[model samples]
Target: MNNPSLISGTTFNEIFAIMEASFPVSEIRTFSGQRALLDNPNYQLFTEKDTEGKTLAFLAAWEFPELRFIEHLAVNPDIRGGGIGNKLMSSYIHRSDKPLLLEVEPPDGELEQRRIGFYERLGFQLNPYSYVQPPLRAGQADLPLRIMTYPQAVTLKEFQRFRDILYTEVYRITVPSSR
Candidate 1:
């Protein structure tokens, strides 16, 4: 796995292809917008590639002085159901120096529950505080999501701090209403 601040065009295209296939438009930035994030000192794109140089999985994360938030993680769609996600997450968590956080949809469906379970197996406890993910792009509705934390659960104060950072730093939004 390589967490690179700068990636070659070919590698980026490969990663972006997987991202587009894995996430909805509402959940990701535009191609140019994503490319621009490499300039941000706090952002890192961790990619796991095969011996043949194909991107197997990736995680886009933002680091702060006290915490880290994972924005996106996806396995190449063609290789779905493989152990790549588990391996990728295991590697990332092993390298974390502070509290870790990520967002997930509520367990209202089989797929959502299964996704939460996958992270749970990796040791992320779903936080109980209500959260609504800010619109990632203009005109999109806020996405109802839950935050999962590593090591242990966060208190309401920590959750608020993390959410504030996500709004003011990551999404650059005014605090939006939540559930």
Candidate 2:
């Protein structure tokens, strides 16, 4: 089995480049903001590299007491469709017993639908409760997203608690409704 190790320094920079290529700017934090997450005790970044030491895939997650929140998961576009993404996710799940939670764009389009299907194949169930992801940067609007939970569905109460933690800890924003 390929071992997933904590990423840092040049490794982190390389993986960040892949993240920028894979996700829209609005969906990701500024590079500096992401770097700051390295200091957070709850944050974790794990990568799988090739013999050449190039990053093949990465999984960034927050290890909260009640849940494991996958902040991002991406594979190098040059070598996708070879199960690298699956391996990364499987490793993450195998290492944690907590219920896993992650946000996803609603399945309104083909790409979005396919992404949801991909998670479902890994045994993650989509939660129907409404959710809004706080903006990664200032002045941007909150993004509407759906929650997917591993092992089972999440109730509105559970979603609300998760949202509060993410808004306060991850984004440092007060949930509008809470205010």
Candidate 3:
């Protein structure tokens, strides 16, 4: 049976492979920039493993005293349709004592809708706030990002505060200045 586990240095390579397969290289920078946030006292990585002990899925998050921000999540393509993703999310939510939050792409098309549906199925609700995330690259266009909260309902003002904190603390720390 597949089981979820907390990822550590021993499983870093396997976790990176799952992330690379699930997201574009540029969008998966967290795998490379994780060190910068390690000292933040809130970063955590959770991974799911198969019976053979191979990492199959991962969820990274930052936990504040009163909130948890899901930073990244991915399931190995080879095991996508199985329950790994859902299991990983359930594990995190179960462990979180405070409200859980995440950012997702706006429902611009079928893909976005499906993505939103996945989170919704896991008990997350969309926060009625609009936000534009900083561009992935300097020349890339800024994308519309939406906030989703689990368990607790969030107000537009609260969502905006979360976005601003993410932009100033997480984004600034990980993104390098364009030369």
Best by lDDT: 1
lDDT of each: 0.89, 0.86, 0.74
Query: Where does the lowest 10-residue lDDT sum fall in candidate 2?
Result: 1-10
Give me the overall lDDT of model 1. 0.89
Provide the lowest-lDDT 10-residue window in model 1. Answer: 170-179
Best by TM-score: 1
Runs in model 2 deviating more than 4 A are: 1-6, 176-179
TM-score of each: 0.94, 0.93, 0.82
Which portions of model 1 show Cα errors greater than 4 Å?
175-179
lDDT of 1 by residue, 1-179 (tens): 78476577888898899999999898898899898898899898888899998788888899998899999999998887889888878888988669999999999999999999999999999999999888877789989999999989999999998888888889987766561
Better of 1 and 2 by TM-score: 1
Quality of model 3 by C-alpha lDDT = 0.74
- Rank candidates by lDDT, best first: 1, 2, 3
Q: Model 3, residue 160: displacement in angstroms?
A: 1.9
Q: 42-131 in candidate 3: lDDT tens per residue?
A: 677777777787888888787776678897889989778888888888888998578888888888899889989999998999877777
Which window of ten consecutive residues has the lowest lDDT sum in model 3? 1-10
Sequence-dependent TM-score of model 3: 0.82
Model 3: number of backbone collisions: 0
